[model samples]
Target: MRQIPLALLAPPTHRFDNFLPGANAEALAYLRGLSPGDPPVLLWGPTGSGKTHLLQALAEHWQAGGQRVAWYDADTPLPWELPAHESLLLLDDCQRFDAGQQHAAFALFVASAGQGYNIVATADVPAVDLDLREDLRTRLGWGPSFALEPLGEAEMRAVLRREADRRGLLLGDEVLGYLLTRFERNLKGLMTLLDRLDRFALASKRALTLPLLKAMLADEKIDSDPNL
Candidate 1:
């Protein structure tokens, strides 16, 4: 398929490069081969499962390739009736919207398919079970689907390594292991924990050690449980 000339579909947003082991490359490969004929894909995973990252990565990849892609969350109208281009549409958190959006999204899917445009959406549930129009449900099943498995311990470690590298933080294995054992196994939780530790360490001008880490975590627990 010819690359679409990028038009003002949507503005770029922030994206992070902290994919777990074996996941970043796989998701990238999936998007690289995508054509308009590829069915509208629905990525189902719990919050902090890297669904957003994968979708954002795909959007960025397409944008960089000169494809006219529109990316937004469920808060926006379905771009069903927009003029067609070599485009990609990324709709995030569709589950939060009303049923009308689902039906409208189906119409957009039809338009995109006709023009060889790509549509990628994400939700907490599988597309088949999403409260959407029947036709939309059927259309969603026509494409390839992928669910991100919850990160395992080693995967979490890998994620920590990647995130630390991205942020240029010197996170030691001992500190990472300590945080992992005491925290929830979700990316958001891990990031929050790391942010606090980094901030506290910086403010106090102290190296991230076990005692400093414990005090920081203990103080965080007072406001509420930091574990999500």
Candidate 2:
């Protein structure tokens, strides 16, 4: 197996909650199987959805229980070299791998599938469209390939409320409703906005209000630049 790049495979700094209502059930079920041992699993979803969150949650769970866990992200090259022995494997954005990485990833997938070592992958499309090698695609589809859909309005609101609570802030329905109407629809994007707003508010000695949100939204320079 080839060595996966460290920067590309790392998970996010923030915590991902697994209790999201709209999160895929089968995906959670696959994660649950990791309790006793690592099981190879794959999750599919679009950007700004919950793919990374779920990955982080799974990693945190295993790590908390004193299990060895590793994560690989899109920035890393594909066909990740599997560990010599058994350990949880999380390869995100499996489809984004280059041709060589894809071949390597397929081979690793085969090995992981055979051993039932905990493995999870995320892709933009289903396995078929990933341009994966034939055998590897079949193996990914063979088990349960969970698709994470865009969170609905209600679910998104709940997520905002919960995250706000976690941050020791008060988020009312009015604020949530305003954000839902004005910001991007995805939970991930909304969370990003919330995090930024929280920091900005604290620094500027302002409250979380519609005026501030509007100011944040209207800042064309920041709005266009996602990293802002």
Candidate 3:
């Protein structure tokens, strides 16, 4: 029998379809219907508000449609030369960009104008609050801006349930309720914890139940392993 690696059983793909838009319905619709001539989009929200997921979804959407797409994070240096034709550019964590990166980003923004290129960027705060240069900040706000709202309790629960279903885990209502009440509230953190629980369940051949979850936490405490 071939053993399946943990890497192969990693988290589900982040797509627009699985996203629970809640109050961001308009923003979701806008991104879904993006075209070549569409204005650049600025997505700002609190941390863990699904900004990165939306950017990834947009990149995937463009890539699937045979469009040239480039995805970049602020931690890395932005390339000076970008394609001049119809291209899709996605930048995440814009709040962390340094002065040099900001200059490069601004140049890219200017080069993309009226060139059939669409840029989508995400930041923890609005353009006015970003730590970038004044010109870059103004350019960031020149396009449509959407503030992604955090998922509410019911929405979070729905997301958890949907993720569990994708992994073929028949999580009981009691288990889901326990997780929501006892674990982290942020979707990303909760999803990480769920991944750990799923691995533990598979290794121990135990069904996902409240008791099993409690046991797994106890084992992590004893082992003192951060990954657990």
Candidate 4:
């Protein structure tokens, strides 16, 4: 049997509006002010901290302005070509970059400095802790750096309830607490889990609760990885 692609099912999107600021309101505000020729910005956070969301949102914002955006991730293969003209450079997952990617990223930094293009990059750790070459790592700290943090417990609960209410789905207090503790704490992971539960609850004609959520995880086999 052929399986349907997840994109066609529900393509993922990252918009500034969808992000819950929690304690990152100032950081969010900073990103919105970005434009062509802005200095590089470094955003560092653990998984589920919405770093990816913000980076992609930047991409969309630039593209909407009819500015060309060049994207490169640590997972992207070698021979990575830099854009010829001045363009927005979005570098993601800098912590995982190998030696070759590090060299390319250093070049991108030079481009942003010399060519008047804006650059934004995300990593799992702060610049001082980044394990790349010294000069490249130093370049990462050339501009404003924000440490994106996970939402507090109360904030996460509120966000979950707001999302559930927006979707007209019922989730209990127990369910919310369980999600915060048992699953990943990042916004994207929690939202994905909530989306999954929404579909599962509808299909099974069941009221969402802690027990049913556990059952769904058991059947789905995604709970083995906390970051999933």
Tens digit per residue, CA lDDT, model 1, 5-62 = 3332232243434345355455556766787657678787788777787787777777
| TM-scores for all predictions | 0.77, 0.79, 0.87, 0.84
- lDDT (Cα atoms) of all candidates against the true structure: 0.69, 0.69, 0.83, 0.82
- Name the candidate, 1 or 3, with the larger TM-score value: 3
Order by TM-score, highest first: 3, 4, 2, 1
lDDT of 4 by residue, 1-76 (tens): 2232242234445778877877788889999998678778999988877798898987888788888988999778
Q: After superposition, how far is residue 2 of candidate 4 from its true place, in Å?
A: 16
Candidate 3 global CA lDDT score: 0.83
Model 3 TM-score on a 0 to 1 scale:
0.87
For this target, which candidate reaches the highest lDDT against the unseen true structure? 3
Give candidate 1 regions above 4 Å deviation. 1-18, 21-28, 77-84, 222-228
Show how many residue pairs clash in every candidate, following the order shown: 0, 11, 0, 1
lDDT tens digits, residue span 82-186, model 2: 777667788788777666766776677677665647667888788877777777677666655778887888888877887787676688777788778755687
Question: Model 2 residue 52 lDDT?
Answer: 76
> Which model, 2 or 3, shows the larger TM-score?
3
